[model samples]
Target chain A: MADYKNNTIPGLIGFFLLTYGLFFPSLSAEWVSFIIDRLQESMEIMDSGQLLIASFAYISRNALLYFLIYFSTLLIVSALTKNTDSIAFSFLFISATLTAVFLINEFYGESSSYAPHFFSLGLLLALNSYITKQRYYYLTFAVILFFLITAMQCLNLIPLLSQWSFGADDLAISLKTADSFITEDQLFTALYFVLFAIFFLIAVIFALLVHLFNIQITTLKRFQVQEKELKETRFALTESKVYEEIHSLVHDLKTPLVTVRGLISLIAMKYEKTEDKKLQDYLTRVDHSIDKMNEMISEILYENTKKEIDVDEFLRYVISHLVLDDQKIRLEMEVQENLPYIHVNKIRFARAIANLLENAIISFEGKAGFIQIDVKKVNDTVRFQIRDNGPGIKEELMQEIWKEGFSTKDSSGLGLSFVKRVVENHQGTIFVSSTPGSHTQMDIYLPVSSGQGGAFYDIDHR
Target chain B: MKKSSAVIGCFLAGLLLAASPFARPDSAASINSYPNLPAPIGEETILFTSAGQAPENLLLAKMAEDLHLEGDYRPRALASDLYDYRTLVIIVGNSPYGLQYRNKTFTEESDRIKQLLNEAELREVPVIILHVAGTKRQDNQTVELIETTAPYADYFLGLKSISSSTKIIESMDAANVPVTLVQDLEDLHTPLNSAFR
Candidate 1:
């Protein structure tokens, strides 16, 4: 977007400058006349030095006027239209008319000449350019018009040069022989025509050059966007490959870990009456470690593919499983009735919510705790807020809680980080606020429109 | 009823007859008036650029040349030898730049033109006054030159833009000098041809 804006201003300026350049000769003539009128009051005679200075001043004054007009018009019209093409066309049409009038008035005042012929031809080309849809055709037409006008001016010199070669008497005789003749008038008219035509041709070339530069800028911007997208695709591909290897290694260990848990449960049931406090404590610790490992493996294997999920059903399933595992923690749920369907990866979102519930239950350390979960629609977002009345998180730790490999008390540092990843994968945001001794509230917001969701994840992983 | 119709017919005829003299042909429109001056011969017509050596003299000289008159325009103030020319053409307009080139003041240029016109009068060389292109240098000297010399001109040729004002035309009319107003500089050829013939 920044690149788009950056190129448009130059395009408008180039168009205006070209128009101004084409009309510079006539404007310069006016400047010279104005300066001479002002100077005549103060000085009776103009020395050669003064004359040279005045001539240069005449050209400078015209250039200054052209800049002032072009810049101001560009600014005002650009502000009004905002679209580059609109501003350019408006400036082009106005400038073309002004240039035509200036040329016509300068060349022949109420006299017949070849100027009108070239003027009409140039105007027609410009009009045709307006009708053409392709930008290149428009530019080509403009170039041809400027070149033709210049050619006409150059051609006018042929008759003039012939008359110049003759001596005054021969010229007079030749002029006399001609049926329709204008002597000195034609000379001055043709001279001004050539002058203005050259000015316009130079202007056209400058405009074309600026236009080409604008095109380069636009092309560079597109290239940059493509380069960024290519980098992202490569990174995603590398990450997916690494995850595939890790998932296979962890899958083999999952079977052995499940068999060990089954054998421990069978032995514990057989020796149910044996009262060994140290032995039971050690067994419980082992059970917790195995559960943490399984949870880590499950998080690693999680993939977030977008699909419409019923908020109430997903939350009820998550709460039922969490309640069974931690019977001491009482779960109070408030789900808004007639809840809107949410588009997301249901498994990833449920994991995020379950992580928050587990964190709330752990904060009690086996003491009875109240974990409240609320879900409701807010504006264009579906919001879920989980609150715990256990000893809340410290303010200093809150900032560091979501960092990867940074955990308060964990065997692996993947718990909160995994939760953050799942929430983000569903294009939802999670934030927590706590008053250290009172309570912690973890709020998650997901946009109703799931444009940010990774919809093609299933195809990529498969 | 017949008598009334006859009266209306006579009134309409009177209106057309009155309009006929004012309705000039396209060729004659450029000629304001042509005085009864003799046709200029090749050897007797001399063109003088007065007051500032303005371009008007060269332009009118071209016109005269095209009319087959054998005289080139000259920037001359000393009209003492004017007796050789039968028709004297003085192109008068004051340009400060032209005066600066000659190192002369407007008063000096105006005096020289008055003196030259007096010389032409003394030599009995009929004068044709041309007020052709430009209104830029219509300083006091230009107006003075017109007032002082136009009365003596046998014929006056002016472009429409230059002579649209009745001031100079009225003065020449009082002097019984013929005046011609050309719509454009190109229109001057017809009256000039007639004058040369």
Candidate 2:
């Protein structure tokens, strides 16, 4: 998460900057020593109240110095890496280095008064690294801890500093000459215990705050995901309701279509032997138109009714529905031999193919154009590729062409959407490829039926 | 059994006898080691102050009170405080911490002591130098303060335990200032009481 490989060098640089800034001459450490010396002098002459006030000032000054160095290095590292996690890692690096320095100083018996405070700061920084997600919360806690630790150091309350030369020696010297010094020492010791309790309480409170914040964030994220799912469910429900209404309307229209078809059949039978040939041809054409309307109604109402049919027969049925009355367009068909049979709804699948052909023809705008249809077995699916040389679909409108109401011409835009739905319902995939002002290609793959093929073609003239 | 008890008692007596010389009263030895002052060198109403901003001035003030001597303690006493006092008792010791607390550099402290001593001389008040904190206080800063204030002092009182007491006494003797050495802090009241009226 920290991008360790990329951040290692910058992290190390930050660590060095922090370490050297604290310990280098005329830097934070020297400034702290100067202030400590002044505080020690003040402690010798001041009353109890003045002493407490001076100690607070001393602690604040040292805390501010350390914080400046620390925060500056943190900012520089953050800017260099431009990663949120890197700040935590850099803090960890700096804290560890300071800890090592503190341990070494402690082992050699040359520990400064502030060494324990640095060690405490390192522990807090390590805690910050462990909880990387809550950066702001941990950073605030770390700053507060830094101030408290600095106060602890200035008061000489840390056991190691107090028991050693800096605090103990001064106490021992004062003890020999004044009882008031004893009282001051006892008072500081009590203050130290009180501060220690507060430090522990603050740590607990910080942890609790982080926990509460995490719970709140998790709940918020969960609510967002649920809200998104709810919206999608509502949209799908509305789409299903519309489809149900359309299915009912198409079913109602089929009853009237049957009555008209029956009447035409009866009329054709009565005029079977008429001597006027033009009237007979007109009646035959009207019968054929009635059959086409019936097929269209079936396609809309029973799209899922499927059966196995030969790819060649299916293509033929699809081609028969196309009106190639325009003389300027040439349609070519290529069907590979021994192709697998496809399982599909005859009325719906044929109409879907006819819709694609009709779209290619309309793209020509009455100009001379070529349309190519190819049928082949690709693995287990039969791929039908339709290519047109008319002005191709624009790239930006490729996806829009499949929507239920999208069209470039003065017509209802249901053709491509219906084709896409029919193909998908029969376990097929369709893809379109086009270059603007050049050519458009559509490829549809339908899964091969596993069962034996059968002649299921039905043209109901009635 | 009786003879064994008598032997144990004799061993314990011998141990005490051997420790007796090391445990002699330090005040008696301190008095025997130095000659008493010819007479009380200064009067009451003394001004107790520090030449080097040392806390010893506080201890000297306490010692003055124990001897029923009227005195006021001011670790940072200026030359103006010398007008009402008949005798000035200056504690000579350096504490860098104390100097810093008073916000005075060593040079500034020495100058203040010099001015106070000059004012004491102008007022014809007797100046007594007390160097009670022993060898530990004999740093360069304290030694410089001693050199600065020693020329105007009528008497020099120091703890005998100080390693540089001989040199300090030699300088005071060369300056014809009376020198008194005490064995410890408690022994300070003897010379202090005698020096006050």
Candidate 3:
């Protein structure tokens, strides 16, 4: 968790002090063994027991040296750059793994050999960060650091390391040096270091590449989700397109129909004056068909585009305009006075609601019946329930009731279908239930307001 | 570039003269630990980060070679060729197992490991995970996943002792392959950890 570069000195001091505390005598005695070991083969300066003691002493001192350097470096680096950026995580993981490897190698490893595990750990950390987010220059720096490591390690793994003997202390040639005491085998060791360095560096690069691929694949999935959302938003916008096309079609038809009607009336008036009863009757039929077509177009346009009008005002307009068969209708109305302004296209909602009420009014088959209309705001919801005491719809026809043109006593089949569309556009739910003679009920649930200034809401059916 | 040239020189020289004159492959190739022992080829060993050290990588490589498997020092590279070989040695990667090591988010890097482990099962590859493999339980999902995955492994060897009954310490029971503790090999140097090669 710590990233320090400058604080490493104190950290190094603390680490060495801790390790040294565990082996003060041995660390102090390490130099003695080291000196004797150098002159060993010729003079046999140390005995087997002394040599054993010396090896342990050397290992303890090395452990102290490593602990001091690694922890101190970690502390300073982590401290200098408080680990906030994404790379910080990688740094900590690398440092921790390095520390673990160093500790294990220190406590249990051979005195004559070394392990480059921490170097690998460091490289993995740096590579992991670049792969995590794929910033540009990260990989370039990684390659440079790797090259430096390989070059230095080669120096110690091959003969150049062993080429320097007991008398070569004055060489002071390179800080990248291996154990000076083991001068005879230095060449072999240096070579080993170099080969291992290159191989391990390649391995680190390989891990980074794999990490990069996985990140890209995961991002691809997110892009796919965004694409799906875009398609849906476009589909939602299509409603407006269709409505515009329908309006223009109505306007075009109306102009031609008005001309035809005017011409027919002029002809019919002239013909009636000449005592032609047949022509008058035929022209009246033509006039009726044109009136019906105009009415139908208006309803379709109103239903398609949902713009709300006042529920009370819209209700009165529907009753006055669509007075189906006033005979069997015993109309009863109950509505809340505290009702807020509803957002629905007035023309569309009025036609849809009237269509349903008209169905209820005429369902008794021209027989006398009671029709109930209730609109009340309960809690945060406004519910519209219409019930009638008629023979109720036949059980077989219940499912078919909402389908266009499936009406039992119908003219055009579009009325109920239009009602369903308007209700859905207002973000409302509709339910239907019927009992033989008791009643047939059509209930609706809709939100009174949407707050953001639109009558429309997202509609989903599952 | 000079360093590379020096390396090439040393490599040729080392190839010519073996570290010990008698230990050359041509000479030692005939030596066998068992009657059917195969000559050791170039090793594709991997040193994983399990046990927070490179124990998985090092231990797995040693065991693989002992069992006549081919591998090398860094196992990450083998990621590409994982399914190509007859047998492979894997040291489990590092994981935040103990509460002392818990961080904020989950580390699914091991998800790659789990993928390889499953593929190995299909290809009949037997893998060995060290002691740290038994310790990953930071949440319910991980605990469930570990339990789910434990049954798929053909040979599950544990480096340290575990508490579960079916989890024996290496008696070679397949239905309940146990954790086996092997005697330590040469421990590596601490100074070498921070050192270059």
- lDDT of all predictions, in order shown? 0.56, 0.63, 0.46
Q: First chain TM-score in every candidate?
A: 0.41, 0.57, 0.39
TM-score of chain B of 3: 0.40
The DockQ for candidate 2, computed on C-alphas, is 0.03
Predicted model with the maximum lDDT: 2
lDDT of 1 by residue, A1-462 (tens): 885565566556656665565565445554544444433321223133333343234434533543333343434344445543443444443454345435533542211122333343334333333323334543544444444444333333333322222111111121221211343335434543566567566655555565566578679989999997786677567767866887798788899999988987886776677798777877788888888677656755656546677888888768766754645777788989888888866556676788788878878889887888899988777889898888987766766676555666764455677777777776777777788778888877877787643311110000
Model 3 C-alpha lDDT per residue in residues A1-462, reported as the tens digit of each score: 133443455446645544543344334443533523332321132133433343333334433444433334444444445341344434553455345445533543211122233333344344444443444333443444344344333433343332221111111111111122223234335444656567556756665665677688779988999987776566446745765887788768878888988988887777777666777778889889888666756665555444445668766877787665557568888887868767766667767788788788767778888888898875565778788898776677766667655566647556676778778877776777887666888777777774432233222111
The 10 consecutive residues of candidate 3 chain A with the worst lDDT sum are A166-175
Q: Ranking by lDDT, best first? A: 2, 1, 3
For candidate 2, write residues B1-197 as lDDT tens digits: 33233234433443444343344333323232344477887887889898776543456665666788887888888899888889998988775545654677878888889999999999999999988655434455677788777789888887675533455655665677777776656667777787765
Q: Tell how far residue B157 is off in model 2, in angstroms.
A: 20
Off by over 4 Å in 3: A1-121, A133-191, A215-244, A260-347, A350-376, A379-462, B1-197
lDDT of 1 by residue, B98-117 (tens): 45445677777777777788
Q: List the residue pairs that clash in candidate 2.
A: none
Worst 10 residues of 2 chain A by lDDT: A453-462
1 versus 2: better TM-score goes to = 2
Q: Which stretches of candidate 2 lie over 4 Å from their true place?
A: A1-14, A21-26, A40-132, A135-214, A306-424, A430-462, B1-197
Question: Of models 2 and 3, which has the larger TM-score?
Answer: 2
True-vs-predicted CA distance for residue A83, candidate 2, Å: 15
